[model samples]
Every structure is written in structure tokens, then in C-alpha cells.
Target chain A: MRAQSEAHAPSRMVSETDELCQKIRRRKPSIYSELLRENILEVLKCSFPRFGTALAPGKLDEIASHFLSRHGAKRPQFHHIATEIVEFAHRGHELSKPLICLLEYEWILLSTEIDSARIQAPQLSGNTNWDTSKISLNPTAEIVATPFDITLVDIPVELDGTEQNYVYAVYRTVKHTVVTRSLSYVDYCLIDLIRREGEVAFNALVSAPPVQLTTDAIRQWVIEQSQNGLVICGTEC
Target chain B: MKENALGIGLRSELLEALCIQPAREDIDFLEIAPENWMGIGGRKRDQLDILADKYPLIAHGLSLSIADTVPLNVGFIRDVCSFLNDYGISIYSDHLSMCRDSSGYLYDLLPVPRRKENIEYLTGRICQVQDIVGRQLVLENISYYHRYEDQMPEAEFLAAIAEQSGCGLLLDINNVYVNSRNHLEDAVAMVRCLPSNAIVYYHVAGHLELEDGSLLDTHGTKVGEEVVRLGHEVWGWHGPRPLLLERDNQVPSLDELIREVGDVQKSIAAGDRYACSI
Candidate 1:
């Protein structure tokens, strides 16, 4: 039982030893702390460049240190750490809504670029039969609504926290290039519906609440989005 | 890849440069941290496919955390093996230190206690990893800063693990030099202590010296002259192995790195000639 416990929960076996080493590490300041701290900071800086710039002096470092002290051991991958940094900022930092939104925007861009999930759109030899086809958004596509125009902010000061009422779609194209597009509320609602339902029929989409569009408008919009590689036309209705 | 071959750690920064010159003669092979490539897609995946076709790739994992007392991360090891199999790479190396504890991954290699008693524990883990990888798991000696109580020399610990577990060793010459200087040990003697049969490859990289004289394994700059001299001694002792140039940060242009690779090759040849004459 002891051996089994040691094998399964190795930390339990050496909790005292680990504690001792942690104390020694703190006193001696090994390369581990510096290297780990640097990795976290580098990821945060790269993921949200504007956020790094906006934070006051040493705030970014504090955040990185906090993250390292808290979640450093938890995340081994760079993207995973980046995600935790964004999450920590939102939950703990009391960051401005604009700043949080900006971080989310930047994260979406970084996340979709490397997202492994692929969506295979059904091959349409003829034109996509809009009336009978099921429509779905690309798996890599993400939609976010922000209170402020975080995209328009050029500098830290430009983000005045005023409401800009922005809705955006960030998705990776077939070529794997991440593209961000500002979306109208109606388009946002349609994408949200497709995202929530997984697959939506053409009539169902047109008849959906918050999407009171004519058949022609809906068809045109779907075609436009398809051209943009944001929407995929699935099986025959 | 041939013995005495030169390779470079393939960083994403070098992808554009590497893609342009797939047939470059200076780089005999490419080493990658499989952790970076696994479960990733997009243009990066496409780039990896192109490069894999061009040069033979070896897997050097980052998050194995082999020395952790907890159960082995079998899932991650399998994924790494899968990546290696996909690329037709059989040589896989990771640090002989813990990266993850019970809480989670530290994202940095922490020192494994070098006491004699650890040999059995470490041996078991190493053997388990080798079994999972379906190949000899080559363990690199990490540059640790501090010493622990009742610690044996790192060389002894490493040699024991390699011999007992039948694992291979990646002799990071820079790390050896750093640890030697920091801990007041003879670097060459440490290399001599390691079992020759277990030493499979060599890692030559740059390091930074702190104000207090302790060396940091930064891998930021060019391989230092002292480390190159040590490499000469290492190759002379172990004969020429597949030596990889690791530059994790402040990476220069490909041309500059290629030139550096050429320099190391020349040094290794000179060392071999010296050994033959002796």
C-alpha cells in the first residue's frame, strides 16, 4: 500500500523533502524561479502586447510572479500558460473591461492560429443549395462582444473605457491564417445560433429569433460568410 | 543522421529560414521539443511537415518530469512517442530532472536530488519511461543551481541511472561546465566518470555568467569558447556523437548559426585527431 501510494502520489512520499527544497530554493534563488518566471512573462507579453504596455510599472512582473507562484507548475504548454494569464487577469487583477476585452481579442487570435480542431465542410459541386442545406460555423471560429472598441485603441490612454458596443468574429481560414472581422449584431446573433446549435437548417436560421431576415438576405449573408471561410454548409436539409 | 553529425534545435523563429533552405548541408539533422509540436496545427503544422521531409528530426521532450515521485505521465509519454513515430525519429531526450510536481508542471527543470538512495527510484522511473517510449530514453543533465543534503556527484547519479535503467545519456557539455564551475568540480573528470557506453549524443550551447560568478544555462548567446574546448575534450573521450547546437533565445540568422555549426564540426574533428595521436 505504501509503495502503491508512492507510485501514484509521488508528492506525498516526499512532501517534507519537497518542502525543504522549496525553502532552500527560496534562500538560494535557483535558476528555476528565474527561468520559470521569465517563461510566464514572455508568454504574457507575446499574447497580449497591449496589455503589457497598459499595465503600470512592475504590474506585469507582479502578475507574472503571481501566476508563476500560483499556476506555473500547472501549465506546461505555452498556450495553456497564456490562457491562465488571461484568466488570472480577468479574475484577480480587476482590470478595466476594455483591457480584459483586448486581452480576450488577442488570445482569440493566438488560440485559433494553433487550434488543432478542423472542420471539414461538405463538398458542394453545385452552388450551396441555400434552401435545403444545413449550415454550421467553422470549429475554429469564435465570437466575442465587447463593451468598448478595444480593437481601435492604439495606446494605453486610448482605451478610455467608453462603450463602443463591438461584436467580432475571429477564425482561422483554411490556410491557417487567423482573421478577425467586425460583425454586425445580426451576423453575431446568427453565428452565435450556429455555434450553440452546432448545425442549423436554412429555414430554422431564418426563422430564429433575433434573426428576422428575408430568405434572400440570409442566403446572401451565408454565402458571404462561406466565402470568408467562417460558415460551412453541411448535409442536405 | 550520420555519427559525428551536426544538428540544430529547430525553434519556430528559424522556421522561415529553414523552409527556404531545406537542402542546407550544414544542418545534418534537426532536434525539436516534441512538447511544442504535439497537438498543434495551422501553418506551423504545415511548416513542420515540410521540414520533417527535408531533414531527419529527433525528439527532445520538455515536460516529461521523470524524476517526480508521482506516477509517470503515461499519456504525455505516449503522445511524444506517437510524434516520434510519426517523424521516424527514434532518438528522444529529456532532462533528468523534475518539471512537474503533484500540483502541476513547473515549466522549468528542477534538480533531482543526487543522493545514492535516489538511484533505485530514478532507475525505476527511467526504465518505465524507456518501456513506454519503446526505445532508450536519453536523459540530459540539467544545470541546477543549488546543492542538496547528502548529494552525490551528478556524474555518479547520472551514470548509475543510465547503467541500471539501460537508458542513454545526452551530455550537455555547457551544462556540465556550468555545474562544474558553480559547484567547484572538475568538468572533464565528471565527463570521465560517466559510463562511455551510455553517452549517446552531445548538446553544446551558450550560457551566461552572473555577477557572483555562478553560470546560468541561458542558451541565449553563441556557444562559448571554453564550452567549445570542453566539447573538444568530450568528443576526444567519447568519440564523435551527434552534437546539437541549442539556441533557445536571441537566435541569430540561419547563416550565422550554420557558421557556428561548422566551427563545432572542425573542433570535433581536431579533437578526434588528437585522441588518435595520443
Candidate 2:
């Protein structure tokens, strides 16, 4: 009797998940991942009282684990789960609000922990003090505020050969007063240096007595900054 | 009204092109969205300043929401009026729909209920807008889906609004085609009922048809045959109004859109001469 009850539980969960998927799909025909569908339904069930009655508890976690394992995601990241919940809520899903709110709180906690870890981690470069005042935010930078863990919500659990999630992000732009293809901070420093001590060639940036630098390193940095759209190649009039 | 003239929407995207194009020669009057440049400072304002100096421009907006029960957004009205005064933009227009509610804005041009109450409310709002702007404000009929049950027929509602507001009507022929297809109404009969004397302009654009046979007013493609015919008919009755070709998304090359506008002008001219004889 116990064995039989245990076996029947999963089928019931699958049925409940399928119903929720259909409801979401009816409104927005775009979302098509089985894992994302199950995760969203789980979030809905936990956050919404009506959904809880319809779907069994712990079923959502089971489905999420299955999805995470299949998609090569760390079980803890939960970025996919968070992202899905936030996106659905953004689209005006009634159940998405509470879930998104919970997810955001969770992300704030995670970001705090990550920042502490970063402080302990070995420095990437010897010069830790970098000027960022010259860097301006891109005009199109968009910041989406949601209640849930948007990143976890969107992580794909099951990948069929044919499906993908539509990831939305805040668009931002940085403007440079002078043109040089360099990382925003580096270009900012270079411009400041030039203002302070007239024009300098590629070698001057490396040979500046206060900061030890290499010609190859400066060139690479310039290339990287240019690629990032932080630096333009001409002086502003 | 000219045979080959095509007016491009003066969006920031085409500011560079506008700067380089020999002013007073390359294109006809540029149509600007008054809301974008109104009360805005810096680069966008500077760009408009240069363009307005050279080209004859008009203001087009999306947020009038003329039929809402809520009082008009006074700030928006003042800003638009200031813009018109600064730019000397005489032809100011918005859609004949309500976009906001008491709660908040919908960010889409939603359809207004075509009821007696709505008509009265909209007419009063239009009068207020015109009085504030100090110019004749033209309202364009919008494409709609899921119309209210208590609404009057579209033609009767539009004709009533025109008569009551004493404002010019911007007859959007493509929207009529979309609504006609969606609701299975006679587009020609609807066109005939419009107050011909009040029509200030005509608009033509593309629409997308969904799998369920419902039409979406996408404005992202070429104008259809039905819209062209409706445009010709409107020109036949109202004489030649400034016919603008509106393509917001999926816009083809300027050459292609200009060609389409050229065909429309030819048809309008032919229809105008024919109607004059009668």
C-alpha cells in the first residue's frame, strides 16, 4: 500500500504541473521549456494559496532538481528558477508577484555573501585602485525590479534540441568625452594623465614612474576597453 | 498632396540623415512626435532645433487618451502647447482612444467604448486640448479588438465626435481596413459616414493577420489593397488631404516606402479630379 501511494504521487504532481503550464502558455505562447514550466508552477504553488491546493508540496523541488541536473547548473545557483518567476510576473502573471519578491530577497542575500568572498579572494591585479568616475552609464541601460530570483527562474533545466528562453536585461550605455579604445577606467586615467601632462604615446602609459606597466599589457587593455565600448579614438572638442 | 513627395517621421534615428539632406529640397514636411521633443533639453532638443529651422514639421503623439473619464493630464497638455509654440508646429494630432485609467497607464493605445457617455467625454476633452494648444487638434480613429457591448457603431461614434469637437479628423484608412476585416463590417459604408469637411489628413499603414483570423495592427509592413482603395475613396470625397504613409516597425528601405506613397498620391490626384467633375 505504501509503495503504491509513493508511485502514484509523481503522476499527480506531473498532472498538476501540466495544468499550470497550460494556463501560462495560453496567455503567453512563447514559454516552451518543460523544466521552466515545472519550476514556474512550483513557484506559483508555493506563493499562491489556490495553487497550493491544486499542486502537492515538495513536487516542485523534485522537478527543479531533475531540471538542474540535466542542464549542468549548480543546484544552489537557482538563477534559472529566479529568472523564470521574475519574467512571468513581469508579464503580469497574478501568481508571479510573491514568488518574485521572495526571489529578490534571496538574491540580495546571495550578492552580500559573494561580495564578502570577493574581498578574501586573491587580487587579480596588483593595482587595486582604479578610477571609474569618467565612465557613464549607457542611455539604454534598463534595470528590471522583480520580487523573485529572476536569474534562477530562467536557468534551463531540460534542454530539448529546439527551445530557448527569452532573456531580458537592463540596457545601459557609457559615453566618452574623448575617443580612445580602452577600458572605461583605464581610458579615464589616461585622459586625466594627458590633461595633467599633455599628450602621451602608448609607451608613456606603461612607463609612468608611479605605476609600473608593460607596453603589451597597455595595448591589450586598450583593445579590451575598445571592445567594451568604453573608449573612443578621438578627442572631444 | 504632391505626386512624388514623401514625409519621413522625424525620429532621433534619422537625425543624421536629416542634417545631411539638403533642407527645403530632399523631402517634404517632416512629421515629429511632439511628446519626444517637448520640454526635453540637450542633444535631442538641439537636433530638433536644427531640423525645425529648415523643414515644415507637424506634431504626432500617442498618449492623448481622449475618451478617458479621468480629467486630462494638464502637464502633458501644457508641454505639448509649449512645444507647438516653440516649433510653430500647426498640425498637432493624437489617436482617438483612451490609453490611461484612474489607476495607471497601460502603455498601449487602447480602444475607448463607443458609447454616448464616451463620445461626450471625448468631445469635451478634445475641445479642452484644442483650447490649450491654441490650434485645431486632429484625432485619428484607432484599430481595435474586443469592442464594448454597449458601444455604438464606429462610423456613428466617429461622426458624432467630429461634429461635437469641431476638430479635424485624421482618417486612418489602414485601421479601418483592419477593423472591417476583424468585425466583418463594410469599410466603404463606414468611410462614407465620416464628416468629409472635418477631415484634415489621411494615414495608411500595414497590419498583420493572426492564425485565428484576427488582425493585429502592427504597422510593420506594406499597406494592403483594401487600405489603398479606402484611401482613394477618402481622397475622392474630402479632396486631397496630406496623405502620410506610416511604417513604425519592420520598415523597408526609404525608396520602397516612397514608391508606395507615390502610388497613393497618383491615385488621390486621379480621384480628386474625378470627384471635382461630379
Candidate 3:
């Protein structure tokens, strides 16, 4: 029994202390819980202004509390927490679609702007067969398909899901500026296909159902995106 | 960095003003959280590069969790080392409290039990962190809400950790003041017991006095006169360590922060003269 107690000591301490932490957080009038809740709400407000106004008083606190209790052990960096809040909010379907879309757009911009991953430079592979070359989106880049063009709206109040057909490719440039560009439907379809599949051969991209554009047009677009650092070709084949 | 050097935390909100005027006469050094800057690029990275190039940067980390029960995060320590090396920062400090548990990071500086076993547990962990960091890990005393039963004095607990692990202390005056007010302890007595040589620097900030009369260490306001006075007393005891003003939220313009820096500098000068007289 002594040996068993000794063996369980470390685990026992962790459980006891962690449980205490949970209790302290849940206890009424807990300043610790208030601090955590306030911090999460502040970050979200800065990132998602419209959504901040959309939520009622203490609503964000409840949501943030739920998020913290569920994922308490996960390290809470500002960007990571923001990402989790976006996902959590989406899963709950509490906010309107437009608000969610705006949150997603802002999150992408914020995350990409600060992303430190060094993506490989888009280089033209010297392969002979161009149709078989691999294509990929820049790791720092993101693509969004919104029903309406919410990007132009300064304040998003209307929740009406208008289908204005907006597809955007938000990416940071080599100069370190984050810029968004509108993509043609064909280009969006092609990029979406590439996103769904990790990296695709040029031949596969051309044969994909979205490639209603001429083969030459698709080839031109791929080369243009590669040169712009949006995608990389595995080989020039 | 000279003794009694006045510094300010390099918050992102004040980045633009700082960049335009990087060489403020009153400012001595800049403190940054390595966790925030690590693996980040673009405008923020560029801004960091510009500021780091101009100032002597010190790393005051928020996520090291040196007092936790889990195994040390060697990868994060290595990453911090890499960043420090990249930018030529020497002093790396974190709170001497647990911010994480086995389940995950709690994202708050939770109080560690002030018992002998915890001291022993934390001493070993601090040593491991120091070994990995390749320098002495300076720990700050955090202000916490809850108190444990059969616990040693907070100052004694911290001193024990430092003595056992051979680590340094970042004596945050505002935290001392806040904890003393909240816990009904003698703030000056606690500061007096800390080993003088172990204190590497000082952190002074403003805190909020809640309706309950308990103080919260919120770095969102101007540095209070009482905290500044305590800082002066600390300088008198330790003979003027670097005093860093931390303004993490509601950060004002650079001019305003620099003015605060100048205020601390004036107090330090006064303390210096007072020391010379004695």
C-alpha cells in the first residue's frame, strides 16, 4: 500500500491541484475566472468587432468560460484562442452566417499577417511534362468563399445571406503586407480543389470538374499564381 | 545596462510610435514576451526587428510555467534560447508560478502550494530550466487570489526556490504591493527577506483596487504613487536595479509612457543621491 501510494503521488498531486484550479475558476466572485474571461473577451473584441457588438452582456463571458473549461489545459496564445473561439462559435451556430464569415475573414488576415512559417518560394520545376506538376496554396495564404461581399462593408449589421458571389484569396506578400484579391469562379473552383486535395498535379487540376476554362487559360492562371507566390509547382512537367 | 536603468515593456499597441522615435532619451531598455514574438512574421516581426536593433531587449516570458508538475517544455525553452540568441537578449525571466497543468495550459498564473514538497519540486524544475536556457532563470513573484493551508511565507518560498536552484529574481514591486494588500501581509517585510544578490531587476506597474478593496495587478493604468514609493524603497535596499514599467493594456502613446519612464528615472536618481549620502 505504501509503494502504491508513492507511485501514485505525482498523478495524485496533478489531479488534486488541477481540480483545485478548476474549482477556483468556477467559484463565485472569482477574480481569477474574471481575469481569464476578460482577457479572452478583449482579444475577441479586437479581432471581431461586429461580433463583439452582436453578443449580449455576459454572453461572451459564458462562451469564453465554456471554452476555457473545455480546453483549459491547452496553451492559450492570443491567436490560438482567437482561432478556437471562431471554431467554437461556428460549431454552436449562435451567431449569424455573415458575422461568422466576417470573423473568419478577420481571423485569416490576423493569423496570416503574423504567421512565421517560412513557406518555400514558388519555383518553376524543370520537369518536362507540365500537366503532371504539383500545385499548392502558400501556407501563409487563405481562401474564403462568402455568399455576399462582406469585406467591403465597414460595419456588418444585416444578417441577410445575400449571394453576391464573392470569392477572395487573402495572402501576405514577400514585402510583408496582407492583401486580398478577388478570384474568378473558375479560379476559385480550381483553388478549392487544390485545397481539398493537399497538392495536385497540373493534369489533375485541368481534368477537375471546375476547369471549364480552356486548358491554355488554366495553364496561364497557374503560372501567374505561381509567380505571385500564391501556389508552387512541384515540377514544370 | 546601468544600475537603476529605466525601461518599459514593448507592447504591440505602442509599436508605431516607438518605431518612429526608437531612441527616446529616457528609455534604457525594452522588455518583450518571447512567446508573442516567436514564430511570427510580417509587420509585427519587422517592428520587433527595428525595436530590438535599437534597444537592449530583455525577455520576460508569460508561458514558461516553471513551477508546474509536468516535465519541462524543453522544446519551448530551446525556441526561446534561439530567439534570445537571434536578438542578443541576455536576461530571460518568468513568473515563479504554475500557468499550466498536465491537462493543458490554464493561461493564468495559478498559485503553487507553498509547501516543502512544492519547493523541492520547483527547485528541480528551475534547475532544469536554467540548464536548458544556458543562463540563470530569473523568476517574478506573481499576485494570486487563493492561499493554501500549512503554507510557508510567500517570500520564504520564493527565496528557497532561488537558493536551491541558483536562479535570479525579478522583483516586481507592484505585485508585492498587490499581494500584501490582498493577503494582509507586510509587503516591506516580504521584500526585505529576499536575497539582495538574487534580485536581477525590478518591475513596477499600476494595479486596480477592486470594490472589495483587494488589489489586482492590472498593468492598464498609470503607476501609482504608492507603488513608485515602494520601488524607491526597493532601490534603496538593493542599490538601484533596472526598474521596468509594464503597461500591457490600455497602453498610451509613447510620449506618455516615456514620461512615466522619466518619472521612474527621477525617483531612481533621487534614490541614488540618497544612497550616496548614507
User: Per-residue error at B194 for model 2, in Å?
Assistant: 1.0
**How far off is residue A92 in model 3, in Å?**
7.2
lDDT of 3 at A9: 22
Ranking by DockQ: 1, 3, 2
What candidate 1 gets wrong by more than 4 Å, as runs, is A1-17, A20-30, A90-96, A119-128, A154-165, A201-204, A207-209, A234-237, B272-278
Q: Candidate 1 vs candidate 3: which has greater lDDT?
A: 1
In candidate 2, stretches whose alpha carbon ends up further than 4 angstroms from where it belongs are A1-237, B1-6, B24-26, B271-278
What is the clash count for each candidate, in the order shown? 4, 40, 5
User: How many Å off is the CA of B45 in candidate 2?
Assistant: 3.1
lDDT of each: 0.79, 0.56, 0.77
lDDT of 2 by residue, B118-206 (tens): 55556666877887888888988888764555568888888998888788888888899999998999888898888888887778777
Candidate 1 lDDT score relative to the true structure = 0.79
Q: For candidate 1, lDDT tens digit of each residue in A54-130? A: 77799888887776555434545545767777777776666766667778888888889998887564344466666
Residue B38, model 3, lDDT: 84
Ranking by lDDT: 1, 3, 2
User: For model 2, what is the alpha-carbon lDDT of residue B271?
Assistant: 49
DockQ of 1: 0.40
Give lDDT tens digits, candidate 3, residues B54-102: 8899999988887677777778889888888899988999998877766
